[model samples]
Target chain A: MADKPLILAVDHNRRNLELMSQFLGQEGYEIIAAASLEEFDQVLGKQADIKLALVDIAGFDRSVWERCERLRAENIPFIIISPRQSAAIQQAGLAHGARGVLVKPLAVKELLGLIRSLLGE
Target chain B: MSEKRLPTGIPGLDEVLQGGFIPGRAYLARGGPGTGKTTLGLHFLTAGAANGEKALFITLGEPEAMIRQNAERMGFDLSNVAFLDLSPTPEFFAQVETYDIFSPAEVEREPTTRKIVEQVEKLQPSRVFIDAMTQFRYLAADPFQYRKQVLSFLRFLVERGTTVLFTSEGSAEAPDADLQFLSDGVIDLEYAPEGRILAVTKFRGSDFLSGRHSMRLGERGMEVFPRLVPEVYRREFALEVISSGVPELDELLHGGLERGTITIITGPSGVGKTTLGLQFMKEAAGRGERSVVYTFEEGVETLVGRCEAINIPVHAMMERGTLEVVKVEPLRYTPDEFARLVRREVEEEGSHIVMIDSIAGYRLSLRGEDLVSHLHALCKYLSNMGVTTLLINEVEYITGEFRATEVGISYLADNIIFLRFLEMRGELHKAIGVLKKRLSDFEKTLREFQITRYGVKVGAPLTGLRGILSGTPELIE
Candidate 1:
């Protein structure tokens, strides 16, 4: 059997985090949840083999950008998630080194497809 | 009696206050953290500076650099504004001692307020902002003495024609009601579970907006929004027919939704309330008009997927900035925060149509606590903005009388469109009716509806039905 991809989802909204975790978990992915940048750092320190991350832009602070920049330097892939799907925000996310931007209440199938493409699945 | 006015420079705010703040008078801005008090003070002074008036911002607790950084993020160029930082020093202590002549121990403990006043005097600014007054409370052992000192400092500013905006951290019961009373005006910022709300607790000698209004701190600064009043709304805007996105439903609504008015779509569980709301959003977005959907029940992706099934292309509209979808669980937010989020979409995105998918979900998420007032405030706020608001309300069952829970929302709404499941010939059928529309004449008929791949379609009316409200109607065969 193929190894389960470790997916990290960061969001301050607990309900959203839980929903995303459940949805992704049902699809054979190991979901790691981080509520804030502080918790995200702790998770990153412990879980060294995270294949991808879906960071909620609403919960994102300035620190998240710096962390994403560091992740880019280390060749780790991350996607920006937001309820707002404005072109300006999408462009800004791309400029910040995000592989893609997922507009929220995400399409599970589309998100999965994007993740698979990014992971070369 | 003519009063001096201080312009906040925020367009709507200036208009609401009949030009601006009472000139040469001190105002107290009190709120907890993230309440936009600091932002308002900054905007006040920065706005003054923009108008060629010298403004000074004195920092007592936070570092000057931190304030500058925050301002930069909000797009406030504070370079022209004077910054006086009084962190720790004998001079700060001496100023504290002078201000705390009534309470020496308080002065010896925290000297920020006194130093703030000294800086104000030195700068001789046309406008002044004391970042906060919370730190000063610790200086006084007695609350009475603290109030006295605050009054003295405010008097000093008023005497010099320096319009001062003093920010403090606390709710109404913040042990500084006396101080608030002493100020010429008191602007209270509150973070409710729904959204960020700002209230003018007291604006002396002026007919200011009295009740709490929704506001948000955005790229421009503090944007003060006016509350919606349905009675006034009926006076200003004309009502036009709006499509329910279902052809049958459109016929039921007498050719469509009443335009430039409020519409309430009330239904029971699994009655396709959200689907109906989404259809309206889709139609509005399709027309190239901006529409925003706030769903407490569905996620943005789920909503998008549903839209895709209905062939609505919501993501394309969102990318074009013509459509915005926000999923807000009431449990995850206060009333004030929710209002702020709505304000951001309305102001920043210029959304003309807004849909709240099921107020029942919002009520359930909030656990039915003070939601009615919040809704009332929100409805009033949206109506005043002339934004056509569609509020989806979920009823437990269609049998009960058509009345809003406690908040009396039906009375507050400019229009009410009731959705229900009526059983015809022992088979369940969707039905809709226009209960009330304030301005326009709408057909009073219970029309049948169907949920199809395209969206809701309003079929012909169910003839020969008296107990339609009971959900069991005998249709003419």
Candidate 2:
């Protein structure tokens, strides 16, 4: 698990954060969890080899998009986790260079497959 | 099999189907832009929604927002519809599709199928409409893969009892050839210089009206007028003589117009052909039989006004709901569409009298159809339905060497009522003559005709004159 690719998870809800961390951790990926944009920035500041990011863009603010932009600048692929199955939400995520937009509570199999492809597994 | 059918919520279309589309099967609507394909699909889904059935509209062409706006404008409420909008908006038009074309499997096929399947599974809709199914043609450049995806999608939907309708913008050469075999039926709409036409090219298990029928778009949306097949509508009618409301005109018509017969009033313009037809229409209304007037050259208000001035009581008859006036825009209607209007009034609304104000206006609109033959067939159908028909034809020259009509519809007309404008003694005069009446004898003498404030007044025969039938009269010494 420790040798697995480091994946960052950003979400405002603590339960969703814990669930994602546990699920991805059990799937043999090293996980870093953040509850806010400030915490996400702090995590990115300390990490040098973050492989992929999963950001919950539900009720997302300007800072959330800025974080996506930052990840885009770093050549790090990311996925948008939204509570809506709306085209507008998916389009907004795609506009920001997100690899994919999946609705929650996540399609676990599809999400894992997406993570594997994004990480070049 | 008529197991179950998905009703396409367009007026007169189901009648063409003899029922409706088969349930759990896929049908394709093929047409070009401005052919009302998208509008028809919306009607299908909205109708399903109205029936308490879940419905979905997956648009791959126009933005769903624009579609919604258009549907609303057409008086369709789509609040109950679930949409899978994969189309890009104007703001996102410039985004490059980095859909990994190098490996077609992962990029296009999975997303397109998965998106649709996921949405359908979520909504569990009974009816689905896929707009611009041809977009998939571009997505999968490899024809084999495109066919495979579409076939599988159809199979999957049918298995789940999800009846489907998809629209395509097939080119003129072979618009629906690519995926036609995969569909259970194909309803083809064509917009040509001649007119808009629709046909059911193929249907797997059900019978449908096959030949190209005329289609038109109006305030009520798309309506298909199945070709007036006369044989199917032939029936016997009571040979009762109906009054023309004008006592003198009725006397000339041998106690009035006969049921299930065609009477054409031929003359140049402004010779009271329309008013003559209106008199017969007013007579039908008085007897409590419904009548419909297809006013191609005149407005309803103007026709009604003309009738009221002559004490025809057109307004009272209209307000009584015994008569209907359909003012037609010549360029906007086809002969078949006009036929459908007449059929609807007769069959559905129980109209007993059918009148076309002037054939010249009808000819201009539906000129693609051979004019005389089309009118012949339409009149035959009306007569078969036990309805009295009056067609007014305008001659080209008001006072030329006498001709029966410009188009020579004499043989087709069961009765020829000839009205003419003459230069009698340097004074403009009009004459009405019965050229032929198939069912009975008519007055052979020409009558001096006048349009009065109280209506048409006809005088005794002008026995002292000759050559009046040739536009110039001479006294016989």
By DockQ, who's the top model here? Answer: 2
lDDT of 2: 0.82
Backbone clashes, each candidate: 36, 1
Global Cα RMSD, each model: 28.8, 10.3
Q: Write the per-residue lDDT of candidate 1 for residues B369-396, one digit (tens) a residue.
A: 5777877777776766667888887776
Shares of reference contacts reproduced by the candidates, in order, are 0.00, 0.00
Which consecutive 10 residues in model 1 chain B have the weakest lDDT in total?
B96-105
Question: What is the Å distance of residue B54 in model 1 from its true position?
Answer: 3.4
lDDT of 2 at B69: 89
Model 1 CA lDDT for position B49: 89
